[model samples]
Target: MHLYDGHFGGMHLIWWIIWVILLAWIFFIPADIPYQKTIKDSPLDILKKRYAKGEISKEDYEESKRILNSDN
Candidate 1:
């Protein structure tokens, strides 16, 4: 039984490569994770923006805000 003998083996090298790849995949490379994409605007927020930009009348903004906030 060769007790490691203070030498690098094939399995040891392969494991090092595997760990490096796994770590790089986990940290360096970017992937689509939750909350990583651009945030979406809620209907109410969009309605407010439109009203602020003069694209929507005040009545339309109020009605849309009510509809969005309604339980139904």
Candidate 2:
């Protein structure tokens, strides 16, 4: 049995394939860049959230709602 008969060709091919896959993985990975924008809630949506969290009284909520609706 000649151990070196096909070792060079087979191992060289496998190493090349593994190196290509490693390079692709390094370049294609996901990143959260600093310039990426975050979604912002609207004024009315913020008001609704505050009311739901008990930060505003019902009277205040209704008053604010009326004012906001009138503005539109």
Candidate 3:
């Protein structure tokens, strides 16, 4: 009877350890994490990027920038 009780106690301890390890893994492990890309630019910065990328010529860039800054 004593040996049986001791074995049961050991099993309880093992169960608790397993439970804690599972909880820690769930909290610590980042699963299915989303990918995010950051843009650190304002509208003006975006305009500059477009100009730099040759999407707009120098003359067109300046004209567009002026238009953006001007109030309707």
TM-score of each: 0.47, 0.51, 0.41
Q: In candidate 2, residue 18 scores what lDDT? A: 100
Winner by TM-score:
2
Worst 10 residues of 2 by lDDT: 1-10
Per-residue accuracy of model 2 over 1-72 as CA lDDT, tens digit each? 788788676898899999999998878977677989978997889999999999999999999999999999
Residue-level error in angstroms, candidate 1, position 6? 50
**Which of candidates 2 and 3 reaches a greater lDDT?**
2
Tell me model 3's lDDT, rounded to 2 decimals: 0.84
Superposed on all Cα atoms, model 3 deviates from the true structure by an RMSD in Å of 7.0
Taking the tens digit of each residue's C-alpha lDDT, what string does model 3 give over 1-72? 586766677887899999999999999887765676555786778999999999989998898889878844
- Per residue, candidate 1 scores C-alpha lDDT tens digits across 1-72 of 675875657778899999999999999998878867678997778889999999989998888888888946
* Better structure of 1 and 3 per TM-score: 1
Which candidate, 1 or 3, has the higher lDDT?
Answer: 1
lDDT of each: 0.87, 0.90, 0.84
Runs in model 3 with CA error above 4 Å? 1-40
The TM-score-based order of candidates, best leading, equals 2, 1, 3
Q: Which ten residues in a row have the lowest lDDT in candidate 1?
A: 1-10
Please tell me which predicted candidate would have the highest lDDT against the true structure: 2
